[model samples]
Structure formats: C-alpha cells, structure tokens
Target: MQWNVQELENWEELRTYVDTALLPLYLYRPEKPVKEHVQRMSYLVQVAASIEQRLKGRVLMFPLCYQIGDEPLAQRLPAGFAHYVLLQFSGDRLDAHEGEGSRLRLTVGDEDLESALRFEVTIDVLSQEIIRHWQHGGRQ
Candidate 1:
C-alpha cells in the first residue's frame, strides 16, 4: 500500500499486511539546473514505484524526502511498522556507502542510469535486499 488518503482510510484492514515502510530519500542540490533536477526526480519516482510494486502487501511506500546539503532526515514516518528501509538517491556519489539500524540505505549513482537493463537490475536488487532485511528481523 502507499501513503495516501485512500490507504489511510482503509488502515483498519490494511494495517495487518504492512510490516515495513519504504522511504525514498532524494538528495537534491539547489545549485543544479532545473532540467537535471527533473531527471533525478523522475528516476527517483520510477525506482520507488518499482520497489512498491514488487512488495505491495508487505511494504507501505511513503512520499519522497527532498533534502539539501546536510538537512536532517525526515522523522514523520508512520507508526506501527516492524521495519523501515531508506533508499537514497543522489546525482553525485555519497561519502558513506551504507549505515546501520532498523533502516537500510541503498545509494544509486549515474552509472545505474546508463541503460534500462542497469536500472531494472538495480531496482530488483534493492527490492530483494529490503525483503531479505525485513525477513531477518531488520538487523543491520
């Protein structure tokens, strides 16, 4: 399910299947051109939708978190989830590759955008990783 009014309205019945929350973290640079930003945003939505489609019943897809520089991460994640996965995307490479906790961060860069095959593979890997992490009780 997704984080929307329709889903929220059916929360009473839908809550049982939602054990994980999928949060897409988009890192944007204010100095970048509008075209570049739009491309990145498009990729983010595509990747996020792919994941949600694969894990429809088990995960709830939250809205994207647009952050600039070192802005604090979003803290308004809905309650009652057994696990949380934070997928990060940026135009430039990140310094730290990964992190620890109930949250898992998957970072993607320019190379992953070179071809449709590459993008599909990356999303598949991300979806699998999240499912694997959740199955293991979200121990990272």
Candidate 2:
C-alpha cells in the first residue's frame, strides 16, 4: 500500500496488514548541479518503491522528503504504524537519529556509489531487515 487516494479509501479494510511506513529521504545541495540532485532523489524513490514491492501489504510508502545542506532534520514522521523505515542516501544528518525506537534508517550510497548493482544489494538488505523486524515483533 502507498500514501495515496486509492489506498486511503480502502485503508479501513487494508490498514491492518500495513504495519510499516516507509519514508524516502533525500539530501540536496544548492551548490551542486541540478542533475546530480535529481539523480540522487530518483535513486531514493526507487529504493523506497522496491522495498514496498518486496514487502507488499506490510508497508505503506510516503512521498519523497528532502533536506538541504546543513539544515536541521525536522521532517514529521508518519503515524499509526508499528514500524517506520527511513530510506535515504547515507548522510551524516540522518545518522544522528538512526535506530531510535522502531525506526529503521536504512541507507545506501554511503560514499561514491555508482552502479545499479548497489541499489539491488541495498534493496535485499533492507527487505531482510524489515523481515527481521517483523520476526522480532517490531522490537529493536
């Protein structure tokens, strides 16, 4: 399920199966080229979409959220889910809040990450982590 009109309309019936919320986070630097930022953001969204596809009914994906360089992290996380997964291209700003409670900050492209293979690898790792979270009953 996803955060959209159709899903919300059937949320009353399908909400029970959705125990997790996926928030796609991307970072943008004003000084950088527009193309670069767009590419990174696309990758972040692709990751969130892949995870949602892997988990199917267990996860609800939110819109792409972003942070500007050096700004404080103050995005409002989604509510009413047993787990919150923050999917982002690795950065220091988000690292501070990693592993707080049921939130799983799964990141890819920590450094100079180039290649589709990296995205697939990250998707697998994130899917496994979510499965483990479910197995543990949503505990840390």
- The sequence of per-residue lDDT tens digits that candidate 2 reaches over residues 30-134 is 888998887778777888888899998889998987787878777766667778887877654553243334877777775444777877888899899889888
User: For every model shown, what is its TM-score relative to the native structure?
Assistant: 0.81, 0.85
In TM-score terms, candidate 2 sits at 0.85
Where is model 2 more than 4 Å wrong at Cα? 95-101, 110-114
Error of 1 at 8 (Å): 4.2
State how far residue 19 of model 1 sits from its true place (Å): 1.2
State how far residue 125 of model 2 sits from its true place (Å).
1.2
Cα lDDT of model 1 by residue, 13-89, tens digit: 98888888777777677787888877877887778878888988888888877767665544555567777776676
